[model samples]
Target: MLKLHDYWRSSAAYRVRIALNLKGLSYESHSHDLRSNAHHDPAYKALNPQGLVPALDIGGHVLTQSSAIMEWLEETCPEPPLLPPAAADRAAVRAMAALIACDIHPLNNLRVLRELKNDWQADETQTKMWAKGWIAEGFTALETLVGQHGKGYSFGSEPTLADCYLVPQVFSAQRFGVSLDPYPNIRAVNERCDDHPAFVRAHPRHQPDADTVDSNH
Candidate 1:
């Protein structure tokens, strides 16, 4: 059986959950409380050297990193493709995914925010501002890209990897109080995804280890 080491609020884990749901794969989720340092446990580190929220144990192999796990799933199970068929189309999807996962998300990850408070002595307000600033910059550009390439979803009429990445970033952004009104197209796509079973089931609040949060976000 496949097992997923997950944190409810983790955006990367959220991406994988969506992918698994889309692929019709069943996985046993092992919840980790990130706020309580459960992710740093030695046993968890053996599975993931980086001690990340998501580490997949499957078929006698432990896979680290969310993107790598998604790619592996894509290769092993090619039923409903998360990536488009065409080379250029796939590249476009990856580019958008990278914009969120690489460019925006890394800057505002939990570790980075924690470091800001612990190492740099940044207050809550400063950390919040930092996160919003980075997300706004990336989201503004993504808005234009989506406006040009999207219809009801981030890449096209159907959900793609771009949508998987986009939804989580929006979740994290809203958690930190980043406004989405500037990107009407993005918001519309987010709304559409919110109604999707794959996205809905993968939402943080829907997880077994979900902590209380404002439902309005």
Candidate 2:
């Protein structure tokens, strides 16, 4: 059986979960408690040298990186396709996905936030500000892209890879208090996709590891 090593709140891992559900593939989920530093354990490190939450063990062939995994799934499954048919359409979808994964998310990943607190002495407030700032910048560009080019969706009327990546990043933006008012297109696309069962099930609160979060929040 396929197994996914993941954290419930990690957006990167969330992307993979959505992709897996979209394919309608049954898989086991192995929770890694990020707050407890379980990702750094020697056993987990052996699986992912980067100590990241999303490491997919596909019948002994380990796959790292969420974007690559999503693309691989699209290629291998090829039903309910996550990409568009035209080359230009596919490129546009990929461009939107990269705006979040490469430009915005990398700067605000778990390790980066931890380093800011540990090495730079940034308080929680400051760290949160940093996260919001980058997300806003990225969203501004994406909003424009969607507003000008999007047709009821990020690329077109159908949900594609862009929608999969967009919804999760928006979820993180909301977590850090990034206002969604400025990105109507993104919010609209997110709202439409959120109604789908695959997306609903992929939400952080619904994951197997979700119970680990403190109830106080």
Candidate 3:
């Protein structure tokens, strides 16, 4: 069986879980509690020098980075494609994915928030505002793009790599209390994903390591 190093609430891991579920591939989950610094353990560090979550152990090799793993899955398991067939459509979907994975998520992720609080001396309110600012900015741009490109899902009728990146970022935006009302297209896509079996299965709340207590970090 495949082994996936994961943390329940990690957005990166969440994206991979969605991809795995969408492809109907099964994997074993290994939880490392980020709150308790378990990701910094020497063993996990040995597995991934960066000590990031969502490392996929596929027999002889381990894959790190959610984007890379999803691409690998697409290459290996091409039955239910995550990308559109047309080259331009594929690039458009990838652009949407990068908007979230690169522009939005990185600015508001746990590590950046921690840096804001610890090093920058930002209070909770300020840190939340910081996250909200970036999320709102990214979503504003994404709304326009999705409005133009999306059919039912982010890129088309079927869920694509764009949706894989989007659902988690939407979750993060909600966690930071970013308002969704202004982005109807994004909201519509999220609503559609809410009913998707793959997305339902990948939700952080359903993970084995999920905590009953809510934590923003």
Q: Candidate 1 on 1-217: residue-level lDDT in tens?
A: 7899998889999999999998999999999888888999999988788888788999689998888999999999997998989999999999999999889999999889999999999998999999999999999999999998998999889998899899999999988998899999999999999999999999999998896764421
Query: How high is the lDDT of residue 117 in model 1?
Result: 92
Rate residue 145 of model 2 by lDDT: 82
Candidate 3 lDDT, tens digit per residue, 1-217?
A: 9899999899999999999999999999999998888999998898899998989999999999999999999999997999989999999999999999899999988888999899999999999999899899999999999999999999879999999999999998999888799999999999999999999999999998998988666
Model 1 TM-score, all chains together: 0.96
> Which residue runs does candidate 2 get wrong by more than 4 Å?
212-217
RMSD in order of candidates: 1.9, 1.8, 0.8
In model 2, the Cα lDDT at residue 135 comes to 94
Q: Compute the lDDT of residue 15 as modeled in candidate 2.
A: 89
Residue pairs in candidate 3 whose N, alpha carbon or C atoms collide under 3 angstroms: none
lDDT for each candidate structure: 0.91, 0.86, 0.93
Candidate 3 regions off by >4 Å? Answer: none
Ranking by TM-score: 3, 1, 2
Candidate 1 Cα lDDT to native = 0.91
Question: Which of 2 and 3 is the better model by TM-score?
Answer: 3
